[model samples]
Structures are given as structure tokens and as C-alpha cells.
Target: MAPNKVDIRPGVSVLAVLRHLNYKPWFALAEFVDNAVQSYARHQEALRAHHGDEFKLVVNIDIDTAAPARISIRDNAAGIALEDFGRAFRPAAIPPDRSGLAEFGMGMKSAACWFAPQWSVRTSAFGEDVARTVRFEIENIVNDEIEELDIHEELEDVNHHYTEIILEDIFQVPVGRTVGKLKEHLTDIYRVFIREGTLELRFGGDALTPQEPPVLTAPYFREKDQPARLWRKDVSFDFGDGLSVHGFAALRETANTAKAGFSLFRRGRVIEGSGDEGYRPAAIFGSSNSFRYQRLFGELHLDGFEVSHTKDGFRWDENEQPFLELLREHLDSEELPLLKQAEGYRARPARAQLANTATQAVNNTARAMEDNLPSALPDIADAPPVDAPDEELPHAGTLARKEFNIRFRDKDWHISIELTEDPAESQWLVFSDVAASIERPRRLDIRVSMIHPFMVRFAQTDSEDVEALLRVAAALALAEVIARESGVRHAGTIRRNVNDIVRSALSEA
Candidate 1:
């Protein structure tokens, strides 16, 4: 028989496909954040945390609907060389000498195309006072069209030791409203850069600081002002049908009450944990991650896990399945149960400490009010015992911000409340801050960042109608009742101490 001939279809360009796909806004931001991270990592050889003493990333966002919207990200890192322009935007163009964060070259330009049709990058290298600029028009690239004149070139007139990316005519609207979130995302995603002191983030007048501090605290920290961590020896051994888990079951105490926890890592880089996602079941002390509760810090040396250079550094397999099932199973079967039991034991000390502190606080507050009250006011003895709710109280609001304190056993909890008027937004905020003398000895730090619409109403001035005062009073009273039931003292108690405060605050003349 004659040899059979086969025809093949051309594969789609990765850039072309990425350009059309609507990736999540954060994922797109991740690319720019990664660029900032890599730039600093490359320049700062010591692997210092980002946002340290001097180097930085600045993101400027302007949202004027009528005017053109623009999102610009600028970083103080090693800028691209003019000679490397051709290969910079090409796929899988990993520079031979590239290491640190920019191993894969597709990040810079591809990330822009995820949200905008046109974007521009401007850069300047060390010692060289001049900057170089490049413009990548995704619209042009998608159509497979190229023009000879529109190529990368050096801008000798420009001066700086920095790099910048400007995404013009944003195709994604969320980018405009999420500048705050973008700052947070970058702060967390590039925490290593920050701890190394090689990267900084500037928003408005404040240098963005992550809620969590540097991961390393010892030799590496003193050596290079870098955050270095001692690898954990904890591991899980799976044999036959069951799994055995071993790790530090105690929370490491830190003078800094800031949160820390076990973070997910891919290719030796962290993915999630802290306040973003995942849990550190061991870190019941001051951190937010549940995984850290078990101090489950160690290596999971699984081979052939697909870690793409352009990805957000999430763990994945070639088949696109999340590669954490086995890990999760191990944790659930072994680590979690033990962690829970350990937490119960740890809670005893926390509870006793809280009770002693709470009693003292109540006594102090009572003494302070002793001379300020009217004769008719009841004595501290007659005052109701600190009534705190055993269960968390739910709240919803908009346009108004409220806070209260609760007495829990031996602790004082500070609770903050905020409500939003938007109907489509989340409707409630509820969280607790334990008053631990060693950690949160002073005041409980509670926050409700998001507010619900149902609880939202327009702000009113003193001149409002009688009905308005009544409504406000009722709200305050309800809030007070909820606080009492929760054993939490309302931080805003003084403001709403008298009925007149509510009336005056809500009434509109």
C-alpha cells in the first residue's frame, strides 16, 4: 500500500490564546508583582525580603471614567537591556543567565495582555542614567501583524534606575476599584522580596507593609538583613493503609504579634497562607493560618509537579489537577486531629490568662467611673457582671462604622463594625480579638473591612426628624444588647452611653 499522508493543524500561539482569555484580575496583577519581585531579586543578590530599606514598587491607579483610565506599576529594580528586546516578549525565552524571579521571560508582556490591548514598559539599568522604552500592542500581536517601525529602542533622554509598566484603556473594570486589594495582593505574594528588604511598595503616601513580618529571624537576617528560615524537620510518613504525621505542635511565640503561618509553596516559593488562604492548624497563637498551628513547616518533595514560569506559582500537575489531595488527606487524617487536641490543652492557659486580665480591667474601669457618675448611678457592685456572648454575634452595615468591647473570661475583646449602603456588596462583618497580656495586652485590634448593604443607610446630621433619632437609638440599643450577650465590651460604648448621643448624632435639623 502507498504511504498515507496526514495533514496537521497549526497550534495556537500561547500569547494569542492568553490575550483573548479573561484571566482573574488578581492573576494579571500577579504577573506585574512578579516582575517587581524578580527585578529586585536579580539586583539584590542576598535574597533580602522585598520592600526593605530603599528599593520599591509603586503602583498608580487613576479612575476617571470620562477620561482614559490607566494603571501603572513602577519598580526600582534592574531594568531590561536594550539588546535583549527581541527575545523579551517571545514565549519561553528564558535568558541563559536568568535566575531569581524572571527565569521565564514571558511574564512582562503576557501579563499586560491579560487585561489591556495596549501596554508600555519603560526601564533603566544600573550606572546607566538613560532609560529604554518598549510598547507591546496586544491588538496588533493577536492579529499576527507586525510593523517595521514599531520596535524596541533605547530612550537616551530618559533618566532613572527603574522599570515601569503602563496598561492603557483597561479592558478590565475591576482593576480600577481594586487598587487597595492589588497592594495587599502584591504585599503577600511577594513577601519574600519584602523581608529581604530588596522590594518596597508605595501607595499614596504610605509605604505598604505586610501585616506579617519577615519569615526569617536569625542567622540569615543578621548576615545580610535578609529573612532566612531554618527548614522544618516535620514530615508525614505513609505506610500500608494509614499515614503518620510528625511536626512541632506548639506555636512559636514572637514579640511581634503580627500573624504568621504555614504557607503553601511551589518550587521553593510560597503560594498561599497567612490571611490569604490555606490554614496553619498549629499557629493558634497570633497568626491567621491554621496550618501554622501545627508548625507544619517542612518539605514535600513530590517530583514532576508542573510549575509554569508564568503561573501565579500555584502547584499543579501536567493533567491540570491540583496536586494537594494526598497532602490534604495526610493532614486531615493525622495532623488535624492531633492539632485540635493540642489546641484544647493550650486553650486552658489562654482562658485563665484572659479571665485574670478581664477582672482587672473591669475593676479599673469601675474605679475610673466611680467619681464621674451621678448619685443615682448604681455602685460597681450592682453593675451587671460582664455579659459576653458565647457565640459570635453577626452584624451588617453600610455608611456607618461602630465598635464595641466584650469581656471574655479573663480577656477584653474589641469588636469593630462597619456597614455599607451598596445592595450588591457583602452584608456583615464579625471577628474577635482575644486580649492576651503577652500578645494583645493593650487593646484588642478588631476590624470589619467589608460591609453589607441591608445594614447601610445614609449618614444623618442632628437636625433629622424624631423618627430618625428613634431609629438610631434602636440600632445602638440593639448593638449594645448584642455586645452584652457576647461578653464583649463595646469599644464605642462611651459614644452611645446616653440616649441623647444617638438622637443628636442621627437627627437632621
Candidate 2:
């Protein structure tokens, strides 16, 4: 008997246009995995019985990079049934059921065409006696306006169920760094299924596994003596009209800026937020550098949300704001105040400590300071009378800039210091500050002048002398800000005295 034809005429030309669809490599690969998972779910019982009691759905993706590169993905699931073959191959044809991860029938076709000009799908459905293979030569089909494709079939065991898709002469094959990152994102996207024991996804000969971090369990920073409590909390909220969320929000036992933020899921797959690109809403996380952003992480399952065709993001339709408002209300409740805890908790970083040589250097400096303190300190450190008027700061042509942050007395401090070579500015140290409140971090901006007469005479040619002078200037600027914060009036007195005394008595010129 002659096999039935697959009509792919008018819509077949659309394959050329799909290649330009903005698709990240990881998201594009996920399309095949979604189809495999959906198929496994649709015929779980019968397929499980045929395989074994310990049967688990597995999907493997291989990327061949040598010479003529090719990509292949194979899955152990109920393949395209004979009845559904037409709709499956047709462009933009909706599936019979639109509730699963493969709801948008465009995933396979779009992704396949986006990846290569030629591809083939070979599959044997769960109960079907005949196995079939369908191949697409997109360029020939489009250029020649070909309307029909041959379906090659062969008799097969009725219980065998699997699908294999091979993309030949790959257009954009993943290579080098992309291979590792591709595995990471693919693992993250299917982490929920991996957790639930529903799917075992593999890529490049390795099974992808989830790497869940440990949650924090410590007393709040303010309540040091109190007993420790785990910082993981379950959150559930409804924004009315079928929009809802359920998940757990937590702080990592150790802070990791890159791995933090919410992973929004739908239909047992990540719709938004995977890998380092977690969904961090500014309303809740503030700046990306904020402690909340470095510590807070979660897995949120969204029940009543519409996902994009690519399944990479949700379609909010002006509902995102209200959804966030409710999410914040539920996650940041007064009783459990998650944002406060994330900000209040401080963990020391794990970067390399000072070496023995550095410690010895510090000890030598301290000893020298101890020996010189009595005579030098009394003359320079004595509290000077408040005489200099508070004056406006002068601007400069900045030559270098750097910044560092310090956590002290349970407050965040940002130090933005700069070096300036502008000869028009006579002052050695110029500073400005923004005071910290409950609402904002404290900021101190300092510019040390390198073209002052005293600096030019004493430290212009020696890098070591220039370093010492910069340290002194920065220390003096910091002391001024701290003294003003401590309610000392005319905080500029010490700087004014030092500037004048150095220029008059110590100036080599």
C-alpha cells in the first residue's frame, strides 16, 4: 500500500523565516526535551508497563562538531502517533492538548528549522505496528515550492516507543564555552522534573543533575544571642482571576551573587529564570549588588500564567505589577520579613586571606607607627580648635577612579575615591558624602589631588611616596566624615590645619 503524503507547501516556506527568530542556544535545545517530556507524560502507564517497573523517561542530545557537524536528540517516550503526524509536522498547528510543555506545536518545527536546513524525525508510536521516518529538506522544499513529502515506514514491534531527531549540516553548532553553559541551563530548565523523578535528561553523553544549595540557618544579625532558625519559608499567594504562585523562598547558607533570585516555573518547566539569569524583580531585590540580590533565591510555580511560544517568559498583560505586589506581601510579611533577614544577615567572603608576607608588612608598619607616635601623633593628632569655615568643594579633572564597600556597625558604606591631576585645585584632599539612613547606604566620595605643591615637591617622582601620600589623604577624608557623623562640629578643622602647615613648613619648594 502507498503511504499517505505530508502536505507542507505554503507554510513550508516559513521555515526560512524561523531561522532568524531570536533564540538563545539553550532555549532552542529545550524544545525537543519538552516534546519528549510531554509524550512520556501522555502515555506513562502503558509505556511504563512495556518497559519495566523501574522505567524512567530518558532523553539524550548529542552535538557532533568535527568536519560536517550534526546534532541529534533521542528520547524514550511514546513517539508521534499515526493520527497526530500531520498536525505535528505542520507549521503553527496547535496540538490536540494545549496544557503540557509542548502546547505550542511550533517548538519542534521552529527549533529544527532554526538550527539546520535539513532534519529528520524517526519514531515508532507506543501501540502502532509500523514505524515511520519523515525528513525535511527546507531549502529544496521552499525554493522548488514542493508540497508533498514521502513517509518511509517499516513494520516494528507494537510495544516499542521512541523518537529520534537528527539535524544534519548544523547551521550554528554549540562549541567550547557554550557546551558547558548549555548543559547548565538545560539542567536548570528541567530541574523540577529531575526533582520529581519524572524525567532524566542527558546532553553530550552526561546525565544533567540539579545542584541545589544549602539554605541559611542562623540568628538574625541584630539578634546575635538568639537561637538559630532556618531561613527557608514557604510562600503562596493568589492575585485573583486564576493567577497564583506557590514556592519556597530562601537565603543560601553561603551568599552567592550569581546563583541568586527566583526561578519562575510553569507546567513543570522553567518559563523564566534559569542559570545565572534568575528573575530578580527590582521591587523586591533593589539593586543587583544589594545583599538581598546576593542571598535570596527561590523556585516559584506559577499556576495560572501564559507562557511565550518559546516558553522562555510569561505574558503578563499589565498584571506583573500586581503579581509582584502580592508576591512581596506574601514573602515579606511582618512575621517572617524575608527581605530584612536577607539584608541583615552578613557572611564573610571566602576569598584568599592575607599572606604571611603581607602580615609581616603590616606588623612592621605598626611597629614603626608605635615608635613614632608619641612625638609625631601629639603634634598632629591633638584636637584643633574649630577655625576654618565650611567651604564648597572644588571640581577636578579626575585621572583614576576605584571603589570599595565596607560593612561596619551593621551599616553598608560605599567608598568612591579618585585621583586628580588638575593643577587648578590647590587642596590636597577634597571630599563629599551622602549620609546613610534606614532607606539608603552611606556613600563617601573622595578625590586626592596629585598636583598640589606639597605633593609635586615631595612625592612626584616616587611611586612608593605617592602611595603613602594617597593613603594619608584618604584616611584624613574618612576621619572627617566619621567625626561629622559623630556630631563633632567644624569637622574640617584637622584637614585645614594639616593642609596649611604642610604647605608652609614641609614644602620642598
Candidate 3:
């Protein structure tokens, strides 16, 4: 009988698949770091034997922005052995055991392909005498030109053990800003490893540092009359199946949006929080008043929850629900009343910080104007009175622009002023209505055009006192006219007249 013949049809294009892998530049780069850290952990015994317990696991990321850009991640870890070359580069091969951070076995290849069209790895296993190399080209693979990975071997010292992944013709070169963002993301994601001193990660020669979450000790009540009492609780519970969760919840004396929310960690690495979801319980964050629990923040380590493939979030399976429900129960019974009391103690009508700052600034500017313009302005108080023409004094109606009796419907009007670099040729000042008005108060924002030739000339003076006075005068003058004529049909005419007066006064001063 003839040997059976089999044929398999290709399902997808390799490059196309990689192009849609959905890896952000930073997250893709993280995959390599993840592999290096895991390798270091797996070979801790060998590394210690060779370099002593003082040995530090280091991963360095270097990027070249020249034409045909390149990126390389080098790690001082137990490198790949010659025999494992096939598994390392294969698309879907799994490791012999599920240990360390190397799971699914696709991170390395997927990350490499996502970063560049061609890449190579140079690695030498611990105690090995030869270093192995494997190069991959997506173009070659997609075209079906390369049947197998071409491995190269080089003689090396037995003690040398390291792996360096070099990506050539990088799809995108990370500029300085992009690198900085990457450093921040990686620092947070791998904070646990960095904090424990198990791994030292560096980019452009600077080591990444971990950021610790702030701890809250008291309930945050903005009202000064009510003194705050710090409240905190330790939470620990089991979900059966050898799974458990443990952490602490605290209410602060001041509500901090930045520090609010639950930070969930898995295996010492933060997978969520600082704004990524999953730890919000209705009992804590579910009040009709969003800020009722904004003062609440905490961390919870899910002992048995599985993270998504991207490692950016949790799976949210049935196993995780028990812990969340238990947390909600505790918060509803123990913490809700304290939060409500803190809310009640808060001052009902609080003045905004910006308004207070603006008021203080205006006062200081008025004093400065008095000092600088004491002689600039004519002494009207001491001027001789001029005789009025005996032509019958015009009736009040003829002398006054119609008084509309405009009243602001809102109890408070928030006015903010800012300087912008608009061209001198443009309007000297502009006004815009600020959307998202603060509660109980309407806000109006004004921008003083700094690029106006008049402003530019004043700005070049020896001191900013003159410019500050001019800006404040213009803003106040304009605001006075707008507010006085708010309901008048001809308010635009009044605004123009006010602008002319302000411009003449500023120019003469």
C-alpha cells in the first residue's frame, strides 16, 4: 500500500496577522521585558551559583533612530539553549511547564513581529559553551521561501549567559517623548519586580523606578469646621479552591481623584487601577453622588484571578465575583455610614479656589497700578471745574443709554482671565463662555491676546508690573460693560465702546 498523502491549506497571512495583533508600541515592547524578567526568575539558582546572591538581573532597552532604525532588549538571564531553538521561534509552541511569566509562548514571537519586519536573537544558555542565533524575516515567511529557522552557533566562554533580541528596520522609531511614556508604563506595570529589587530595567541608560500608591488614613471633608477622623480597615477573605484576596481600604481627609479607586494586583504586578477598571463596588462608588466615595481608595490582590492575554485586565470570571461581592458587603455595612457622615459635614456653599486666586490677584494689581500710574494719570480730584454750557441740561433719557436693569439670574458668576500668544494684529482681548459650568455659578473665561503689538511692547519693559496692570484693567473694564449691558439688545455696541475706552486709557498710561 502506498503511504498516505496529506495537504494543509494556509489559513492566514503571517504579516497580516501580526499587523492586527493590537499591541500598542509600549505594550509590545513590554512583552520582551516580561520574557527577560521571567527568564531571570526561572534561572535564579544558576545565576546565583555563577555570580553569587548579589547578582542583579538587568534588562537594557536601546533604540537607534538612524535610517533603518533598530531596537534591542538585552538581558542577563539564563539564555535559550541550542536544543530549544525550535520552541523559542515556533509560532504556538508551549513551554514544558507553566512557570514564571512566560505563558502562551506567543509573546516573544508576536512582539517581535509586531515591532519590525526582520529580527534576530543571540543567546547562550548557562554553562553552555556555544551561543545560538536565530533570525526571522516576515517577508520570507509570508512568501513561503524559508522552510525552517536557520540557526547559527558561535563558540563562547562557558560562564557567558545572556540573550539579546535585536529588531532591524523598525516599523516605528520611538522618539524621546515616546520613550518617556514607555518608561512610565513599564515602571508601573512591573513595579512589583522593581520594588523587590529582583529586576532592574533601564531605558536609554536610566533605570526605571516604581511608583507606590498613596495611602489614605482619614475621611476627606473639605469643610474646615468639621475635624476629620481617619478611618481604615483591613480586608481579607477566601473564595475557596485555595484562592483568597487581601488588602486594605481607607478614607482620606481630602478627596483625591488621582488616588481614588481600587488597585488590583496579580503575582505582584498591577494589572488594573490608577483608572483601569474592575475593582469598583456599588457600595463604595455607586452612590448617586459620585464624590460621596471619591475619598475612598484601596488595593486588593486577587489570589486566583486570571489576567487577560494582553495582561492589561482581569478575566472577570465567576471566581473573581465572590471576592467583589464580599467586598461590597463589607463596604455597605461598615464604610457607607462613615462616608455619608463625612459628606454631611462638608460645607454646602464653598468658594472656588480659582475665584479666590483671581480676586487676590486683582487686588495686588490695583496696588501696583497705583504705584506705577500715580503720575501717569492727570490729578482729576484737584483739577479746576469747567463751566457747563447753559444749553438746557439734556433730559436724563437723552443723557443716559437706556438702563435695562440687567440682573444676573445666577447667584454667582465666575470670571477667569488667561493670557495667550495671539498675533498682535488680532483683537487685543477675546471672551468665551466656559462650558461645563460649575454648580450654582456661571463661568466666563477671557483670554488676553499677548501677541498684540501693544502687549508685546509692554511685556518687553523692565518689569511686568505695567503689563499686569494693563491686562487687569482691560479685563475688568470689559467685564463691567458686558455685565452692565447683559440684557440690552445693543450690548455689542456697548462692548466696542468699552474696548475703545480701555485701549485709549492703556495707550495713554
Q: Which lDDT values do the candidates have, in the order given?
A: 0.44, 0.78, 0.60
Ranking by lDDT: 2, 3, 1
- Point out the worst 10-residue segment of candidate 2 by lDDT: 350-359
Top-TM-score candidate index: 2
Clashes (backbone N, CA, C under 3 Å), per candidate, total 64, 0, 10
* lDDT, residue 215, model 1: 28
**Tens digit of per-residue lDDT, candidate 2, span 1-509:** 13567765457778889899888888989999999999999889887787777788999999999857899999989999877887888888888798888887799999998898899999999888888999999889889877778899999888778899999898877899889889989999999899888888888889999999999998866677998888888989887888888999988887666899999999889988888898999998998667788889999999989988888899999989988898788777876778888876655332121122222333343344334434442432222222223554566565556666654534565666666667777777777776665776666676766566676554443344555776677668757755765568878889888888776776632
Query: In lDDT terms, which candidate is top?
Result: 2
Candidate 1 weakest ten by summed lDDT = 1-10
Task: Write down the TM-score of every candidate.
Answer: 0.47, 0.72, 0.62
lDDT of model 1, residue 58: 47
Q: Assess candidate 2 and give its TM-score to the true structure.
A: 0.72
Provide the lDDT at 491 for model 2. 82
* Full-model lDDT, candidate 3: 0.60
Which pairs clash in model 2?
Answer: none
Candidate 3's error at 465, in angstroms?
31
Compared with the true structure, what per-residue lDDT tens digits does model 3 show for residues 378-459? 3321322122111221111110011111113223334444444423324454554432234533344444443344443343
